[model samples]
Target: MISDLFAKIRRAFGDYAVDKRLLQEAEISKLPGFVAEYLMTEFSMNYPSDWLERLRDFVKRHYFEASEKEYVKHMLVERRKIAIIDELRIWVDLEAGEHRGIIPTIGEVDVRVPADLARKYQMAMITGMWGLIELEYSPDTAKRGPNGELLENPVVVVGFKPFQAPTSDPEILRDARQYFTLDEWLDVLLNTVGYNHSAYQTVEKKLAVLSRLLPIVEENTHLAEFGPKATGKTFIFRNVSRYTRIIVGGMISPAALFYNLRTGIPGEVAVRDAVVFDEISKVRFPNPDEIVAKLKDFMESGQYERGKQRVTSGCSIVMLGNVEVEEREGAYVPVEDFTYILPKPMRDSALIDRIHGVIPGWVLPKIRQARYHLSQGFGIALDYFSEAMHTMRKESLVGEMSKHIEVAGNITIRDERAIKKMMSAFIKILFPNLYFDNRELEIVAEFVVEMRQRVRDWLHKLSPGEFPKDTISVTVRS
Candidate 1:
């Protein structure tokens, strides 16, 4: 079998170390087979030695673990290298001595703004960084034609206010330098649109949320979140980081993220830092397969194909929504059994398999007036962290636990090494150098299974009535 040979090539060639030009050759003479040989000996992942398996194995393997293997797969795709440090050099101009707090960089509004959207934004802003306002634009915004053609115009904005301190006392702004930590400031920006809570207290509790969102945000692209309302789903898109740029829902067009715009510029979605589709269940898919089918390719292969153009838009996506069942106990269906709540497009079993994670939104407490806080001592530089993490992910240097685990039979973790690797790496991301108890590892591991099961259960439900309440459809026997 070519598995041994393939692994051999990878280990020797540094697992696809050469440039793309050298990777493609008419003859098999040009490659190193170390890693190829390694693969053959372990999992049966195979490839032609002449061509770079990273590009050719799109069909051979698909699923990736969020642990170590996920990180490995990301390296194979290899994002375009950027001089992140050199870019930071410009910011040095703003620093004086040991570095005080940084200012939020605001994107200037366009000369002509849509009034409906502007109104909603202003109203949302009144909540002072804790309310979420989502606007859907008319399709005409995405039009390209011979000048004047009528297009659909339907713009709607939804505002969800988060619990925030009532007074605009704005005391925190007097001297931002005195009372904030870098991380706290960052949370302020990200959670700015959500309901108000004590920035100091809630941010500490929500630190895990930031760690979880960081990697996904780094890999931003087309993503949709749908479910029961009030999860504060739109908060991150508006104020979190510069990497994420959002447009309202109603105004979306296929071409907005794919084809050329009215100005002949490729639409924002085409090169979206990241696109978030909130209230996703409400969005009707004209061609359901447009994103769904393309997503399967992007997730599996890291390449998106539309027309003659082949673009590598490396993005990790997040979808958030409430589970439908009411909290009441007397109902025939436990909120958990109510499958009708899942987004219709997500009803496809195959599509469900492609998703990496679907975090449960039910766990977060609802915003309450009593929970609001007036001021905070510290915060983070969101733009800096967003950009920095994006750079670090490109290094393929982050420690991951899945590396040691084996994925031999039926694609579950058969390798004890892989399991350990995942736990260690996961904890590293969260705890870093700090000490954690076994209980922590156990909880994290369970979370992983829970995420995987969510996808599996949804897939099982797609085939029709009466799926087993608890059994998830996965090939892994373990």
Candidate 2:
């Protein structure tokens, strides 16, 4: 049954496209061998274009053609931008047997062959076309055997540690034996994505609004996670889906994201799934003016026009990065700046008001666990359900807190959409059984209010001594 199921899935996702079966036909070769060759022969063809006349269109397409491990930097000129980049050599270590723990190590492998090939690798990185892996070698010459000759076996023996996939908890499945509900599934998902409810005050703070982010991601656009490093901000976007895409850090520019029309038009990556902004605070461009403008329109209206093409892109934009922290448990970001101050173009109040909810990463404690074990019976295929829930969320996603809890009369919502998102997110977090009374509702509302307030106050702190005079205005008076 499992073999049949695997075959069905293979057909569904088109895993055969990469041609691993042919390698397996011999001796079941390791995945990296094929991945490497695929990158070298197939991906290495893309490169830094000629400055002589027209910019080559094929350069940008090289990104998607390359395998994972490449990073892109934006190169914009005359409204025609091309992402130029270098590949990342990813190294990960894992506990062999159960594979419950994933040790992600960052580094690179450099293969130098004169000056021209180096430029080719750089172009691959800039455009998000291919992954640059960790390599350490000198191109000067290969090793020689005893007789002044290049060794027959020239391959260097390098031991590498790869990424570890956490084992599904046996206990969580055990717990699922007790109930058939979405909450149980959420518990598993929360665990799979490395969210430990015990460590962070975030879960406690927003117990009121926990369930909003559940459901599957059915969209084809993009997902970006930009935040301060190590907040687990990127974890959710990265680990959640098999089909969901993730862009880490380095060079994120207009051309890498959208299109550079100097030659033929190249497509942006996030046009399908979510676009996560990692270390978003570090997203700096030579000229912030254009990048800033694009962010604002996209965040608010989801409209991005590159060159002569105007595309109504659909994707969730999640920006997370580390904020400079001075205090122990202060918010990493600011509230007033949540939407508006994120990027300069995002600074417009009208645009800022539309943000669903700025998640407070500062309040979220750092992640520390060898491996995450989800609650029993939690559904592993959460992305699919999340997509289904998104449709349901359109109408059913309203906050039902008022029915059970009374607002303090002080809490006011300038953005009705935000209020709805808070309420819905709360439901999603608390899902399985969302039926709640006024007491439960009140607790949830406090979380909702605190979450936004926490974001706002943190933003205030970023400004020198610009703390709010009466910041804690919306007290969750149950």
Candidate 3:
């Protein structure tokens, strides 16, 4: 059955189909799944039988570990010029009147970038880009200080080739939806993110896993997921999309999340499609009251201001944390109230209300058994898949949603919005062609309402006065 399914996926996606095992076999596990898949697809097409050898060779030659930074630099000095694949971020040094490239692995930040290269890949200046970069070492032209001492690194980025698809059409994904059953499509999505669909036996469990992707596919959809450790809550967010940023437990400042007042630069939220707060329990907000206030404003309107600089971003927010769970009738469930899952700073009712939904993370199985859980079948290349979803975010289905569904219960405006946004996301994920029948719409509506209900329940628990006991329901228009 799995082979047949793989064959079906290959037929449907054609060049986009990728065997996830190749990523591991080629020893590119250090790279992001999307980047590894892109290399696999590119190499296999150009070098069929020997693609594995070519890929392994490329990684060995071009990619370097942090420990090998000195070796790479020495090579550049000896060779004058050398090419490497790395994450390159560019920032303007107005005082110096030039753009500087930051190669994190090599720990070089003052490497000069050509003005033309900076403008050509503007995203590198914003959120950073992973690509093949040619660095030229010329100590003869190194910058000198007022005291006649060297002031900057002699290395400069002379050429770059971004490791990304030149163009992507979400219409291809949308149009291809007609070829698979909804269940098959759900499995396809799971496999694309490096999971075996068979491991999740129930449709509800599958949807629970896919909910991690809501923020990536839909704009400004704030979500939270809490469960026991190793449940794979953060895996998809960290690897599936280059547009997603994950901040592990640490002190978070307004400057890091919003606009940096000192540097006149927009933060992660301004450039990425999604910014995820992982290990939410340990996440700290310095001056909690102030940063949380800014977060509330941004979460509510997608607009923020700092130091007289105002910005608006369509980036979605996601929060993930570990919670205590116990076995209940052969299934794992949370031991404490969901309201206490967040840190004290973010425990306000106003902020909680802004979150669209809370994923029931306990339902997702732990990824302890890799051989059985990891995908071994064909799935779409992550780069192509991520780009497709990024493109799909621009196409809103709320108008189409209202034509077929209605929120018909005691609910606030926020509740209504959350339901519509989540339902629209589900439709975009499952039935992107927008051709689901009434029965199909009802199934999706039921799941969406349940998700929003989790938030409403949390709100009720947090503040009984503001949120009374209420049930959110949806009616499929006949």
Candidate 4:
């Protein structure tokens, strides 16, 4: 029955020409419906097959073609040129003492780029920046590798856009928001994150909203969410945006994350929109104090120094870990000291204070077979929605709070800042184009305050004397 419902939903959205079977073949069907559709739309030619290998063979065979037009015509007919339209993430080959874009599939290819784009492309390669480029494949250096070894294939960059948060127009934003009612918009947003709106209750839907939106809506947003395993905490950062990198369990270094002074290279934080630390409880850092200090500074100020270079970035940091929740009466509640599950260094009061939101992941129900979305409702295509939120990040929605709401006077500046940032992000996510009544604003603001307060409560629990009680509250001033 569920499979039949999913097929019907797929057919309804077939006007977009998405390859639904390709998703199942690629084993990426668990991703959000919109996300799967977006991927298919972009790389439809490659669907249900390893098209990269096919592209490599085409480039190799056509290397000696006399007529460019004839070769391109062949590509057009064969669906080969479509590869150039979809952006691919490739590494710049520095091992050869010359710059070359190395497609993992077409190994050791001589990468060619236009003269005008050389500088920017080179810088991106050196800085560990994700280069989303449309390649012009070539077999020019098929005879020799960069190290004078045998190289069978080479490629060129015909067009490119450095992987960064894309922006959307205000008019488009206004027009898009106008199409959906409040509940419908929420449903769309939830489904965008792979939640079936009809499958969950009202509260779960709301939790899904905050979970999906919190990371995408702003820079320097610090979030920590710990739940039972397989709760899909890593999905958005992993699958939603091209401008995100998820670092799984490892001993992460300040040099790797921020900047490497010896090599004069900027790190992940310098480029990606959101950097998630997955299984953070198990992640070990060599210099805990240095990481904690630098992270604290960066989370607050959005800047960090390595040796002589003071690099700045707007990357949001997300920490995802697994936790064991205990049942209190009938409901599942987080253990009394939730902070104890985190690494000892991360439990610092000052460090905890910097976190904008600490999600109550335990409140979320464990995923079952039926939890997946099979909804008939429409949602923004993943790429468009991601770009819209990226654009919305630049706007100052925090100012809207002053006109309609206020935080308690007892709240510290940091607390207020966290609340305002979280609330503003919620507004951008839930009500883009800044369209919402005072009542709606108040309700969202309260949820934002509560999330922030959870961090505050944890801080006080960890250090009783240093942190104060929960006198702070969010109120609608008008």
What is the TM-score of each predicted model, taking all chains together? 0.48, 0.48, 0.95, 0.76
The count of residue-pair clashes in candidate 1 stands at: 65
Q: Which digits, one per residue and each the tens of the lDDT, describe model 4 over residues 103-192?
A: 433332345544456665554453333333455445543458578764643455666654332334534445556656666567656655
Q: What does each candidate score in C-alpha RMSD?
A: 23.6, 16.7, 2.0, 7.9
Which is the winner by TM-score between candidate 3 and candidate 4? 3
For model 2 the TM-score comes to: 0.48
Query: In order, what lDDT does every prediction score?
Result: 0.36, 0.38, 0.86, 0.63
Give stretches of model 4 more than 4 Å off. Answer: 1-36, 42-167, 370-377
Q: Which ten residues in a row have the lowest lDDT in candidate 1?
A: 82-91
Which one is best on lDDT? 3
Clashes of each: 65, 79, 0, 1
Off by over 4 Å in 1: 1-208, 211-228, 261-270, 328-346, 370-376, 396-399, 403-440, 464-478
Q: Kindly list the per-residue Cα lDDT of model 2 for residues 28-146, writing each as its tens digit.
A: 12222223223322322343243211112322333232333323212121222222222222111122111111111112222222233333333232222223222323222554668
Give the alpha carbon lDDT tens digit for every residue of 217-237 in model 3.
Answer: 899999989898998988898
Per-residue lDDT over 78-149 for candidate 1, one digit per residue giving the tens place of the 0 to 100 score? 531111000000011122211111111111111122344334434222111222222233344533457766
Give Cα distance to truth, residue 308, candidate 2, Å: 4.4
